[model samples]
Target: MDNNAILNVAHLNIKFGGIIALKDINFHVPRASITALIGPNGAGKTTVFNCLTGFYKGGPGSKLTLSSKNKSNNLVEMLGEGFKLQDFINPPAFVKRIYFKMFGGTHLVCRAGLARTFQNNRLFEEMSVVENLLVAQHMSLEKSLLKGVFQTKDYLESQERALDKAHDWLKFFKLDKRANDIAGELPYGEQKRLEIARAMCTSPELLCLDEPAAGLNPAESAELSELIIRLRDEHRISVLIIEHDMHLVMKIADHIVVLNYGEVLFDGTPAEVRNSSKVIDAYLGKE
Candidate 1:
Protein backbone atom coordinates (compact mmCIF):
# COMPACT_ATOMS: atom_id res chain seq x y z
CA MET A 1 0.00 0.00 0.00
CA ASP A 2 1.29 3.45 -0.85
CA ASN A 3 0.86 5.63 2.23
CA ASN A 4 0.22 8.56 -0.07
CA ALA A 5 -2.49 6.70 -1.95
CA ILE A 6 -6.20 6.95 -1.22
CA LEU A 7 -6.81 3.60 -2.93
CA ASN A 8 -4.65 0.63 -3.87
CA VAL A 9 -5.55 -2.22 -6.19
CA ALA A 10 -3.36 -5.32 -6.17
CA HIS A 11 -3.55 -8.81 -7.59
CA LEU A 12 -6.97 -7.97 -8.95
CA ASN A 13 -8.49 -10.67 -11.13
CA ILE A 14 -12.08 -11.13 -12.15
CA LYS A 15 -13.51 -13.85 -14.39
CA PHE A 16 -16.94 -14.29 -15.90
CA GLY A 17 -17.16 -18.06 -15.81
CA GLY A 18 -14.58 -18.94 -18.47
CA ILE A 19 -13.67 -15.46 -19.64
CA ILE A 20 -11.34 -13.37 -17.50
CA ALA A 21 -12.23 -9.73 -17.54
CA LEU A 22 -9.17 -8.56 -15.63
CA LYS A 23 -5.96 -10.16 -14.47
CA ASP A 24 -3.47 -9.04 -11.83
CA ILE A 25 -4.43 -5.40 -12.25
CA ASN A 26 -2.49 -3.13 -9.92
CA PHE A 27 -2.47 0.63 -9.42
CA HIS A 28 -2.73 3.24 -6.69
CA VAL A 29 -4.57 6.56 -6.80
CA PRO A 30 -2.43 9.08 -4.94
CA ARG A 31 -4.25 11.33 -2.54
CA ALA A 32 -5.22 14.79 -3.81
CA SER A 33 -4.13 14.04 -7.37
CA ILE A 34 -5.72 13.23 -10.70
CA THR A 35 -4.89 9.76 -12.00
CA ALA A 36 -6.01 8.76 -15.48
CA LEU A 37 -6.63 5.19 -16.59
CA ILE A 38 -6.37 4.87 -20.36
CA GLY A 39 -6.60 1.93 -22.68
CA PRO A 40 -7.94 0.71 -26.00
CA ASN A 41 -11.61 -0.13 -26.56
CA GLY A 42 -11.47 -3.57 -24.92
CA ALA A 43 -8.74 -2.86 -22.42
CA GLY A 44 -11.00 -3.64 -19.45
CA LYS A 45 -10.82 -0.18 -17.94
CA THR A 46 -14.48 -0.13 -16.91
CA THR A 47 -14.14 -3.57 -15.41
CA VAL A 48 -11.45 -2.25 -13.11
CA PHE A 49 -13.72 0.63 -12.08
CA ASN A 50 -16.60 -1.76 -11.45
CA CYS A 51 -14.43 -3.88 -9.18
CA LEU A 52 -13.07 -0.89 -7.31
CA THR A 53 -16.56 0.56 -6.80
CA GLY A 54 -17.99 -2.81 -5.69
CA PHE A 55 -20.22 -3.30 -8.73
CA TYR A 56 -18.33 -6.54 -9.44
CA LYS A 57 -16.42 -8.88 -7.20
CA GLY A 58 -12.83 -9.87 -7.99
CA GLY A 59 -11.71 -13.45 -7.91
CA PRO A 60 -9.64 -15.06 -5.14
CA GLY A 61 -6.49 -13.22 -4.02
CA SER A 62 -7.94 -9.97 -5.30
CA LYS A 63 -7.40 -7.08 -2.95
CA LEU A 64 -9.06 -3.71 -3.32
CA THR A 65 -7.93 -1.54 -0.43
CA LEU A 66 -9.24 1.92 0.26
CA SER A 67 -7.68 4.21 2.81
CA SER A 68 -9.58 7.29 3.98
CA LYS A 69 -9.09 9.53 7.00
CA ASN A 70 -6.49 7.18 8.50
CA LYS A 71 -8.79 4.18 8.23
CA SER A 72 -8.43 1.30 5.78
CA ASN A 73 -10.98 -1.01 4.23
CA ASN A 74 -10.31 -4.07 2.10
CA LEU A 75 -13.33 -3.70 -0.18
CA VAL A 76 -13.11 -7.22 -1.51
CA GLU A 77 -12.80 -8.65 1.98
CA MET A 78 -15.76 -6.59 3.14
CA LEU A 79 -18.04 -8.38 0.70
CA GLY A 80 -18.76 -10.99 3.35
CA GLU A 81 -17.03 -13.87 1.63
CA GLY A 82 -16.76 -17.03 3.70
CA PHE A 83 -15.28 -16.38 7.12
CA LYS A 84 -11.53 -16.70 7.53
CA LEU A 85 -9.79 -18.87 10.12
CA GLN A 86 -8.99 -15.76 12.11
CA ASP A 87 -12.63 -14.76 11.98
CA PHE A 88 -13.59 -18.06 13.56
CA ILE A 89 -11.53 -17.14 16.59
CA ASN A 90 -13.25 -13.77 16.77
CA PRO A 91 -16.96 -14.50 16.96
CA PRO A 92 -17.84 -10.86 16.61
CA ALA A 93 -15.76 -10.56 13.44
CA PHE A 94 -17.46 -13.64 12.05
CA VAL A 95 -20.92 -12.20 12.61
CA LYS A 96 -19.99 -8.84 11.15
CA ARG A 97 -18.49 -10.41 8.05
CA ILE A 98 -21.57 -12.56 7.54
CA TYR A 99 -23.86 -9.57 7.86
CA PHE A 100 -21.97 -7.63 5.22
CA LYS A 101 -21.85 -10.57 2.82
CA MET A 102 -25.61 -10.90 2.98
CA PHE A 103 -26.52 -7.19 2.79
CA GLY A 104 -23.57 -5.57 1.04
CA GLY A 105 -23.63 -4.02 -2.43
CA THR A 106 -22.45 -0.82 -4.08
CA HIS A 107 -23.89 1.25 -1.22
CA LEU A 108 -21.11 -0.01 1.00
CA VAL A 109 -18.58 1.37 -1.47
CA CYS A 110 -20.23 4.81 -1.35
CA ARG A 111 -20.19 4.65 2.43
CA ALA A 112 -16.47 3.97 2.24
CA GLY A 113 -15.90 7.44 0.74
CA LEU A 114 -15.78 6.59 -2.97
CA ALA A 115 -18.26 7.91 -5.53
CA ARG A 116 -18.50 7.61 -9.30
CA THR A 117 -20.34 8.68 -12.45
CA PHE A 118 -21.16 6.20 -15.19
CA GLN A 119 -19.88 6.26 -18.79
CA ASN A 120 -23.37 7.41 -19.64
CA ASN A 121 -25.17 10.08 -17.62
CA ARG A 122 -27.32 8.26 -15.05
CA LEU A 123 -29.42 11.10 -13.72
CA PHE A 124 -32.86 10.29 -12.38
CA GLU A 125 -34.85 11.07 -15.52
CA GLU A 126 -38.18 11.77 -13.84
CA MET A 127 -36.71 13.53 -10.81
CA SER A 128 -35.90 17.22 -10.63
CA VAL A 129 -32.25 18.20 -10.81
CA VAL A 130 -31.98 19.08 -7.14
CA GLU A 131 -33.79 15.89 -6.27
CA ASN A 132 -31.11 13.95 -8.10
CA LEU A 133 -28.37 15.48 -5.98
CA LEU A 134 -30.34 15.00 -2.76
CA VAL A 135 -30.90 11.34 -3.49
CA ALA A 136 -27.16 10.79 -3.76
CA GLN A 137 -26.74 12.13 -0.24
CA HIS A 138 -29.30 9.72 1.24
CA MET A 139 -26.72 7.34 2.68
CA SER A 140 -25.09 10.06 4.75
CA LEU A 141 -28.39 11.44 6.06
CA GLU A 142 -29.78 10.50 9.42
CA LYS A 143 -31.63 7.23 9.02
CA SER A 144 -33.58 7.03 12.24
CA LEU A 145 -37.02 6.26 10.84
CA LEU A 146 -38.72 7.47 14.01
CA LYS A 147 -36.76 10.73 14.09
CA GLY A 148 -37.34 11.24 10.37
CA VAL A 149 -41.07 10.72 10.70
CA PHE A 150 -41.31 13.12 13.62
CA GLN A 151 -38.90 15.59 12.00
CA THR A 152 -36.98 16.06 15.20
CA LYS A 153 -34.51 18.90 15.55
CA ASP A 154 -31.59 16.65 14.68
CA TYR A 155 -33.37 15.20 11.69
CA LEU A 156 -34.44 18.62 10.45
CA GLU A 157 -30.94 19.96 10.87
CA SER A 158 -29.46 17.10 8.88
CA GLN A 159 -31.96 17.59 6.09
CA GLU A 160 -31.22 21.31 5.98
CA ARG A 161 -27.48 20.63 5.71
CA ALA A 162 -28.10 18.19 2.88
CA LEU A 163 -30.18 20.71 0.96
CA ASP A 164 -27.61 23.42 1.48
CA LYS A 165 -24.84 21.11 0.33
CA ALA A 166 -26.87 20.12 -2.71
CA HIS A 167 -27.41 23.73 -3.69
CA ASP A 168 -23.78 24.55 -3.07
CA TRP A 169 -22.74 21.83 -5.52
CA LEU A 170 -25.36 23.05 -7.98
CA LYS A 171 -23.92 26.53 -7.80
CA PHE A 172 -20.42 25.20 -8.13
CA PHE A 173 -21.42 23.36 -11.27
CA LYS A 174 -23.42 26.41 -12.42
CA LEU A 175 -26.63 24.42 -12.43
CA ASP A 176 -28.55 26.33 -9.77
CA LYS A 177 -30.89 27.93 -12.31
CA ARG A 178 -31.92 24.52 -13.55
CA ALA A 179 -32.46 23.13 -10.04
CA ASN A 180 -36.16 22.81 -10.57
CA ASP A 181 -36.01 21.41 -14.08
CA ILE A 182 -36.44 17.72 -14.81
CA ALA A 183 -33.02 16.09 -15.04
CA GLY A 184 -33.77 14.16 -18.20
CA GLU A 185 -34.65 17.31 -20.09
CA LEU A 186 -31.29 18.99 -19.60
CA PRO A 187 -28.92 19.35 -22.55
CA TYR A 188 -26.13 16.76 -22.84
CA GLY A 189 -23.39 19.00 -21.47
CA GLU A 190 -25.52 20.13 -18.55
CA GLN A 191 -26.48 16.56 -17.85
CA LYS A 192 -22.78 15.69 -17.68
CA ARG A 193 -22.16 18.47 -15.20
CA LEU A 194 -25.18 17.46 -13.14
CA GLU A 195 -24.04 13.89 -12.88
CA ILE A 196 -20.61 14.97 -11.66
CA ALA A 197 -22.31 17.34 -9.20
CA ARG A 198 -24.48 14.51 -7.94
CA ALA A 199 -21.36 12.42 -7.34
CA MET A 200 -19.80 15.35 -5.49
CA CYS A 201 -22.85 15.48 -3.24
CA THR A 202 -21.65 12.21 -1.79
CA SER A 203 -18.73 14.12 -0.22
CA PRO A 204 -16.34 11.48 -1.37
CA GLU A 205 -12.66 11.41 -0.58
CA LEU A 206 -12.10 9.79 -3.97
CA LEU A 207 -14.12 10.47 -7.14
CA CYS A 208 -14.20 8.14 -10.14
CA LEU A 209 -15.38 9.49 -13.48
CA ASP A 210 -15.93 7.27 -16.50
CA GLU A 211 -15.80 8.90 -19.92
CA PRO A 212 -17.16 12.15 -18.46
CA ALA A 213 -16.35 14.20 -21.55
CA ALA A 214 -17.71 11.66 -24.01
CA GLY A 215 -20.23 13.77 -25.87
CA LEU A 216 -18.88 17.21 -25.00
CA ASN A 217 -17.41 19.59 -27.54
CA PRO A 218 -13.79 20.76 -27.35
CA ALA A 219 -14.76 23.77 -25.23
CA GLU A 220 -16.82 21.64 -22.86
CA SER A 221 -13.97 19.16 -22.50
CA ALA A 222 -11.61 22.03 -21.68
CA GLU A 223 -14.04 23.31 -19.05
CA LEU A 224 -14.46 19.82 -17.63
CA SER A 225 -10.68 19.58 -17.33
CA GLU A 226 -10.57 22.75 -15.26
CA LEU A 227 -13.39 21.57 -13.02
CA ILE A 228 -11.63 18.27 -12.38
CA ILE A 229 -8.45 20.12 -11.42
CA ARG A 230 -10.44 22.29 -9.02
CA LEU A 231 -11.89 19.22 -7.39
CA ARG A 232 -8.33 18.08 -6.63
CA ASP A 233 -6.60 21.38 -5.93
CA GLU A 234 -9.36 23.20 -4.04
CA HIS A 235 -11.47 20.40 -2.56
CA ARG A 236 -8.54 18.00 -1.95
CA ILE A 237 -10.41 15.08 -3.49
CA SER A 238 -8.41 12.32 -5.19
CA VAL A 239 -9.63 11.42 -8.68
CA LEU A 240 -9.47 8.28 -10.81
CA ILE A 241 -10.68 8.86 -14.34
CA ILE A 242 -11.07 6.75 -17.46
CA GLU A 243 -11.05 8.91 -20.56
CA HIS A 244 -10.31 8.40 -24.23
CA ASP A 245 -9.59 12.08 -24.81
CA MET A 246 -5.82 12.15 -24.65
CA HIS A 247 -5.69 15.91 -24.57
CA LEU A 248 -7.87 16.10 -21.48
CA VAL A 249 -6.04 13.26 -19.78
CA MET A 250 -2.58 14.58 -20.48
CA LYS A 251 -3.49 18.11 -19.47
CA ILE A 252 -4.94 17.22 -16.06
CA ALA A 253 -3.49 13.92 -14.95
CA ASP A 254 -0.75 13.98 -12.33
CA HIS A 255 -0.17 10.31 -12.98
CA ILE A 256 -1.19 7.89 -15.73
CA VAL A 257 -1.82 4.16 -15.79
CA VAL A 258 -2.11 2.42 -19.12
CA LEU A 259 -4.10 -0.76 -19.45
CA ASN A 260 -3.97 -3.12 -22.40
CA TYR A 261 -6.26 -6.10 -22.45
CA GLY A 262 -7.00 -6.23 -18.71
CA GLU A 263 -3.32 -5.83 -17.77
CA VAL A 264 -1.31 -2.84 -16.71
CA LEU A 265 1.05 -1.94 -19.53
CA PHE A 266 2.54 1.14 -17.98
CA ASP A 267 2.20 3.30 -14.88
CA GLY A 268 3.97 6.64 -14.64
CA THR A 269 3.62 10.38 -15.04
CA PRO A 270 1.81 11.78 -18.10
CA ALA A 271 5.10 12.63 -19.79
CA GLU A 272 6.42 9.13 -19.21
CA VAL A 273 3.25 7.62 -20.63
CA ARG A 274 3.53 9.85 -23.72
CA ASN A 275 7.11 8.76 -24.32
CA SER A 276 6.64 5.08 -23.60
CA SER A 277 6.98 2.90 -26.69
CA LYS A 278 4.73 0.20 -25.22
CA VAL A 279 1.90 2.67 -24.55
CA ILE A 280 2.19 4.19 -28.02
CA ASP A 281 2.02 0.78 -29.62
CA ALA A 282 -0.77 -0.52 -27.41
CA TYR A 283 -3.15 2.46 -27.26
CA LEU A 284 -1.84 5.91 -28.11
CA GLY A 285 -0.68 4.82 -31.57
CA LYS A 286 2.19 6.16 -33.71
CA GLU A 287 1.97 9.87 -34.10
Candidate 2:
Protein backbone atom coordinates (compact mmCIF):
# COMPACT_ATOMS: atom_id res chain seq x y z
CA MET A 1 0.00 0.00 0.00
CA ASP A 2 1.19 3.51 -0.76
CA ASN A 3 1.80 5.82 2.19
CA ASN A 4 -1.06 8.03 1.00
CA ALA A 5 -3.41 5.32 -0.20
CA ILE A 6 -6.75 5.09 1.62
CA LEU A 7 -8.26 2.12 -0.24
CA ASN A 8 -6.56 -0.72 -2.12
CA VAL A 9 -8.16 -3.27 -4.37
CA ALA A 10 -6.12 -6.16 -5.68
CA HIS A 11 -6.81 -9.43 -7.49
CA LEU A 12 -10.53 -8.58 -7.49
CA ASN A 13 -12.71 -10.89 -9.55
CA ILE A 14 -16.46 -11.35 -9.80
CA LYS A 15 -18.47 -13.74 -11.96
CA PHE A 16 -22.21 -14.21 -12.23
CA GLY A 17 -22.55 -17.90 -12.89
CA GLY A 18 -20.91 -18.19 -16.31
CA ILE A 19 -20.70 -14.46 -17.00
CA ILE A 20 -17.52 -12.61 -16.02
CA ALA A 21 -18.24 -9.33 -14.24
CA LEU A 22 -14.83 -8.15 -13.13
CA LYS A 23 -11.47 -9.89 -13.68
CA ASP A 24 -8.36 -9.26 -11.66
CA ILE A 25 -9.29 -5.67 -10.91
CA ASN A 26 -6.58 -3.66 -9.19
CA PHE A 27 -6.66 -0.01 -8.15
CA HIS A 28 -6.25 2.34 -5.23
CA VAL A 29 -7.89 5.55 -4.05
CA PRO A 30 -5.37 8.14 -2.94
CA ARG A 31 -5.77 9.79 0.41
CA ALA A 32 -7.91 12.94 0.19
CA SER A 33 -8.10 12.73 -3.57
CA ILE A 34 -10.91 12.16 -6.03
CA THR A 35 -10.59 9.15 -8.31
CA ALA A 36 -13.07 8.49 -11.09
CA LEU A 37 -13.88 5.24 -12.84
CA ILE A 38 -15.22 5.80 -16.33
CA GLY A 39 -16.29 3.36 -18.99
CA PRO A 40 -19.14 2.56 -21.32
CA ASN A 41 -22.40 1.17 -20.02
CA GLY A 42 -22.07 -2.36 -18.57
CA ALA A 43 -18.31 -1.91 -18.22
CA GLY A 44 -18.62 -3.33 -14.69
CA LYS A 45 -18.05 -0.04 -12.92
CA THR A 46 -21.04 -0.41 -10.55
CA THR A 47 -19.99 -4.02 -9.97
CA VAL A 48 -16.82 -2.69 -8.42
CA PHE A 49 -18.87 -0.56 -5.99
CA ASN A 50 -21.09 -3.56 -5.22
CA CYS A 51 -18.05 -5.65 -4.44
CA LEU A 52 -16.51 -2.96 -2.28
CA THR A 53 -19.69 -2.59 -0.21
CA GLY A 54 -20.15 -6.39 0.22
CA PHE A 55 -23.34 -6.52 -1.81
CA TYR A 56 -21.67 -8.96 -4.18
CA LYS A 57 -18.93 -11.16 -2.85
CA GLY A 58 -16.20 -11.80 -5.34
CA GLY A 59 -14.60 -15.17 -5.71
CA PRO A 60 -11.77 -16.38 -3.52
CA GLY A 61 -8.48 -14.43 -3.74
CA SER A 62 -10.32 -11.15 -4.23
CA LYS A 63 -9.49 -8.49 -1.66
CA LEU A 64 -10.54 -4.94 -0.73
CA THR A 65 -8.56 -3.30 2.05
CA LEU A 66 -9.68 0.02 3.53
CA SER A 67 -7.43 2.16 5.68
CA SER A 68 -8.89 4.73 8.07
CA LYS A 69 -7.67 6.44 11.27
CA ASN A 70 -4.56 4.27 11.01
CA LYS A 71 -6.65 1.08 11.09
CA SER A 72 -7.06 -1.22 8.11
CA ASN A 73 -9.80 -3.72 7.27
CA ASN A 74 -9.82 -6.29 4.52
CA LEU A 75 -13.49 -6.44 3.48
CA VAL A 76 -13.08 -9.79 1.83
CA GLU A 77 -11.47 -11.16 4.96
CA MET A 78 -14.31 -9.94 7.21
CA LEU A 79 -16.58 -11.86 4.87
CA GLY A 80 -15.34 -15.42 5.04
CA GLU A 81 -15.04 -17.63 1.99
CA GLY A 82 -18.24 -19.61 2.35
CA PHE A 83 -21.99 -19.45 1.84
CA LYS A 84 -24.36 -21.83 3.63
CA LEU A 85 -28.10 -21.81 3.06
CA GLN A 86 -28.47 -24.55 5.66
CA ASP A 87 -27.50 -22.24 8.51
CA PHE A 88 -30.70 -20.29 7.85
CA ILE A 89 -33.24 -23.08 8.39
CA ASN A 90 -34.50 -21.91 11.80
CA PRO A 91 -36.51 -18.68 11.82
CA PRO A 92 -34.81 -17.24 14.91
CA ALA A 93 -31.41 -18.27 13.59
CA PHE A 94 -32.30 -16.93 10.17
CA VAL A 95 -33.29 -13.54 11.61
CA LYS A 96 -30.06 -13.39 13.54
CA ARG A 97 -28.15 -14.39 10.46
CA ILE A 98 -29.85 -11.73 8.38
CA TYR A 99 -29.18 -9.07 11.01
CA PHE A 100 -25.60 -10.19 11.26
CA LYS A 101 -25.21 -9.95 7.53
CA MET A 102 -26.84 -6.52 7.47
CA PHE A 103 -24.98 -5.04 10.41
CA GLY A 104 -21.66 -6.80 9.98
CA GLY A 105 -21.84 -6.98 6.23
CA THR A 106 -21.80 -3.47 4.71
CA HIS A 107 -21.72 -2.03 8.19
CA LEU A 108 -18.32 -3.64 8.56
CA VAL A 109 -17.15 -1.84 5.46
CA CYS A 110 -18.81 1.42 6.55
CA ARG A 111 -17.49 1.09 10.07
CA ALA A 112 -14.06 0.64 8.55
CA GLY A 113 -14.48 4.26 7.36
CA LEU A 114 -15.97 3.76 3.94
CA ALA A 115 -19.40 4.95 2.80
CA ARG A 116 -21.25 4.71 -0.50
CA THR A 117 -24.26 6.02 -2.42
CA PHE A 118 -26.15 4.14 -5.09
CA GLN A 119 -26.70 5.02 -8.76
CA ASN A 120 -30.29 5.86 -7.95
CA ASN A 121 -31.18 8.25 -5.17
CA ARG A 122 -31.50 6.07 -2.02
CA LEU A 123 -32.80 8.47 0.56
CA PHE A 124 -35.47 7.23 2.97
CA GLU A 125 -38.51 8.40 1.06
CA GLU A 126 -40.86 8.64 4.00
CA MET A 127 -38.44 10.21 6.43
CA SER A 128 -37.59 13.86 6.73
CA VAL A 129 -34.25 14.97 5.30
CA VAL A 130 -32.63 15.39 8.71
CA GLU A 131 -34.16 12.13 9.91
CA ASN A 132 -32.67 10.32 6.94
CA LEU A 133 -29.29 11.67 7.83
CA LEU A 134 -29.72 10.63 11.44
CA VAL A 135 -30.57 7.09 10.39
CA ALA A 136 -27.26 6.83 8.60
CA GLN A 137 -25.54 7.22 11.95
CA HIS A 138 -27.45 4.36 13.53
CA MET A 139 -24.41 2.23 14.11
CA SER A 140 -22.48 4.78 16.12
CA LEU A 141 -25.54 6.31 17.75
CA GLU A 142 -26.94 3.09 19.12
CA LYS A 143 -23.68 1.68 20.32
CA SER A 144 -25.26 1.47 23.76
CA LEU A 145 -28.88 0.40 23.65
CA LEU A 146 -29.25 0.54 27.42
CA LYS A 147 -28.00 4.10 27.56
CA GLY A 148 -30.42 5.14 24.85
CA VAL A 149 -33.33 3.33 26.46
CA PHE A 150 -32.63 4.98 29.82
CA GLN A 151 -32.08 8.39 28.16
CA THR A 152 -28.72 8.80 29.79
CA LYS A 153 -26.58 11.91 29.42
CA ASP A 154 -24.16 10.10 27.15
CA TYR A 155 -26.91 9.02 24.81
CA LEU A 156 -28.48 12.49 24.72
CA GLU A 157 -25.10 14.03 23.99
CA SER A 158 -24.54 11.53 21.21
CA GLN A 159 -27.95 12.22 19.78
CA GLU A 160 -27.29 15.94 19.84
CA ARG A 161 -23.96 15.40 18.15
CA ALA A 162 -25.53 13.29 15.45
CA LEU A 163 -28.20 15.88 14.84
CA ASP A 164 -25.58 18.61 14.71
CA LYS A 165 -23.60 16.67 12.15
CA ALA A 166 -26.68 16.10 10.08
CA HIS A 167 -27.52 19.78 10.12
CA ASP A 168 -23.98 20.69 9.22
CA TRP A 169 -24.10 18.57 6.09
CA LEU A 170 -27.54 19.83 5.22
CA LYS A 171 -26.24 23.37 5.42
CA PHE A 172 -23.29 22.46 3.27
CA PHE A 173 -25.58 20.98 0.66
CA LYS A 174 -27.92 24.03 0.91
CA LEU A 175 -30.74 21.75 2.02
CA ASP A 176 -31.10 23.09 5.54
CA LYS A 177 -34.34 24.82 4.73
CA ARG A 178 -35.79 21.56 3.52
CA ALA A 179 -34.49 19.55 6.43
CA ASN A 180 -38.01 19.03 7.76
CA ASP A 181 -39.51 17.94 4.46
CA ILE A 182 -39.88 14.34 3.41
CA ALA A 183 -36.90 13.15 1.42
CA GLY A 184 -39.02 11.91 -1.47
CA GLU A 185 -40.63 15.32 -1.82
CA LEU A 186 -37.38 16.97 -2.76
CA PRO A 187 -36.33 17.48 -6.34
CA TYR A 188 -34.32 14.73 -7.93
CA GLY A 189 -31.15 16.82 -7.77
CA GLU A 190 -31.70 17.65 -4.12
CA GLN A 191 -32.37 14.01 -3.33
CA LYS A 192 -29.04 13.13 -4.92
CA ARG A 193 -27.28 15.72 -2.80
CA LEU A 194 -29.14 14.48 0.27
CA GLU A 195 -27.89 10.93 -0.33
CA ILE A 196 -24.33 12.17 -0.46
CA ALA A 197 -24.93 14.24 2.64
CA ARG A 198 -26.30 11.19 4.43
CA ALA A 199 -23.18 9.28 3.52
CA MET A 200 -21.04 12.12 4.77
CA CYS A 201 -22.79 11.94 8.10
CA THR A 202 -21.23 8.48 8.46
CA SER A 203 -17.84 10.22 8.49
CA PRO A 204 -16.18 7.85 6.04
CA GLU A 205 -12.52 7.98 5.18
CA LEU A 206 -13.48 7.35 1.59
CA LEU A 207 -16.82 8.09 -0.09
CA CYS A 208 -17.87 6.01 -3.07
CA LEU A 209 -20.42 7.55 -5.42
CA ASP A 210 -22.03 5.52 -8.18
CA GLU A 211 -23.00 7.81 -11.06
CA PRO A 212 -23.91 10.83 -8.94
CA ALA A 213 -24.34 12.88 -12.05
CA ALA A 214 -26.72 10.41 -13.64
CA GLY A 215 -30.03 12.29 -13.31
CA LEU A 216 -28.74 15.79 -12.78
CA ASN A 217 -28.80 18.56 -15.31
CA PRO A 218 -25.59 20.16 -16.54
CA ALA A 219 -25.71 22.92 -13.93
CA GLU A 220 -26.42 20.46 -11.14
CA SER A 221 -23.58 18.27 -12.35
CA ALA A 222 -21.26 21.24 -12.22
CA GLU A 223 -22.31 21.88 -8.63
CA LEU A 224 -21.71 18.23 -7.76
CA SER A 225 -18.26 18.42 -9.32
CA GLU A 226 -17.38 21.38 -7.15
CA LEU A 227 -18.81 19.72 -4.05
CA ILE A 228 -16.77 16.59 -4.70
CA ILE A 229 -13.59 18.61 -4.98
CA ARG A 230 -14.45 20.38 -1.74
CA LEU A 231 -15.00 17.05 -0.02
CA ARG A 232 -11.41 16.11 -0.87
CA ASP A 233 -9.75 19.44 -0.25
CA GLU A 234 -11.67 20.80 2.71
CA HIS A 235 -13.05 17.71 4.39
CA ARG A 236 -9.91 15.63 3.74
CA ILE A 237 -11.99 12.73 2.51
CA SER A 238 -11.06 10.48 -0.39
CA VAL A 239 -13.61 9.82 -3.11
CA LEU A 240 -14.05 7.07 -5.69
CA ILE A 241 -16.71 7.89 -8.26
CA ILE A 242 -18.15 5.75 -11.02
CA GLU A 243 -19.45 8.18 -13.59
CA HIS A 244 -20.11 8.21 -17.32
CA ASP A 245 -20.10 12.01 -17.51
CA MET A 246 -16.68 12.72 -18.91
CA HIS A 247 -17.07 16.45 -18.36
CA LEU A 248 -17.76 16.03 -14.64
CA VAL A 249 -15.09 13.37 -14.31
CA MET A 250 -12.46 15.60 -15.88
CA LYS A 251 -13.50 18.45 -13.65
CA ILE A 252 -13.23 16.61 -10.33
CA ALA A 253 -11.09 13.48 -10.61
CA ASP A 254 -7.38 13.71 -10.02
CA HIS A 255 -6.92 10.17 -11.28
CA ILE A 256 -9.03 8.29 -13.82
CA VAL A 257 -9.40 4.60 -14.54
CA VAL A 258 -11.29 3.29 -17.55
CA LEU A 259 -12.75 -0.20 -17.68
CA ASN A 260 -14.09 -2.26 -20.57
CA TYR A 261 -15.47 -5.78 -20.62
CA GLY A 262 -14.38 -6.50 -17.03
CA GLU A 263 -10.82 -5.34 -17.63
CA VAL A 264 -8.86 -2.17 -17.07
CA LEU A 265 -8.72 -0.40 -20.39
CA PHE A 266 -6.69 2.57 -19.24
CA ASP A 267 -5.39 4.19 -16.05
CA GLY A 268 -3.99 7.70 -15.90
CA THR A 269 -4.55 11.24 -14.70
CA PRO A 270 -7.45 13.15 -16.16
CA ALA A 271 -5.24 15.01 -18.64
CA GLU A 272 -3.44 11.85 -19.65
CA VAL A 273 -6.68 10.00 -20.16
CA ARG A 274 -8.05 12.86 -22.23
CA ASN A 275 -5.00 12.64 -24.47
CA SER A 276 -4.76 8.86 -24.62
CA SER A 277 -5.55 7.50 -28.07
CA LYS A 278 -6.60 4.22 -26.52
CA VAL A 279 -9.22 5.95 -24.37
CA ILE A 280 -10.54 7.73 -27.41
CA ASP A 281 -10.68 4.46 -29.27
CA ALA A 282 -12.48 2.76 -26.41
CA TYR A 283 -15.09 5.50 -26.24
CA LEU A 284 -15.45 5.38 -29.99
CA GLY A 285 -16.16 1.65 -29.88
CA LYS A 286 -12.93 0.61 -31.53
CA GLU A 287 -10.60 -2.26 -30.79
User: Which of the numbered candidates is closest to the native, going by highest lDDT?
Assistant: 1
TM-score of each: 0.94, 0.90
Show the lowest summed lDDT stretch of 10 residues, model 1: 76-85
Residue pairs that clash (backbone atoms under 3 angstroms), model 1: none
TM match of model 2 to true structure: 0.90
Off by over 4 Å in 2: 83-103, 142-146
lDDT measured at residue 10 in model 1 versus the true structure, 0 to 100 = 94
Query: What does candidate 1's lDDT look like per residue over 1-287, in tens digits?
Result: 78889999999999998888899998999999999999999899999999988888888899889998569988886665666789989998888888888997788888889999999888899999989998999987898999999999999998999999999999888899999999999999999999999999988999999999999999999999999999999999999999999999999999999999889999999999999999988864766
lDDT of every model, 2 decimals: 0.92, 0.87
Task: Provide the global lDDT of candidate 1 against the true structure.
Answer: 0.92
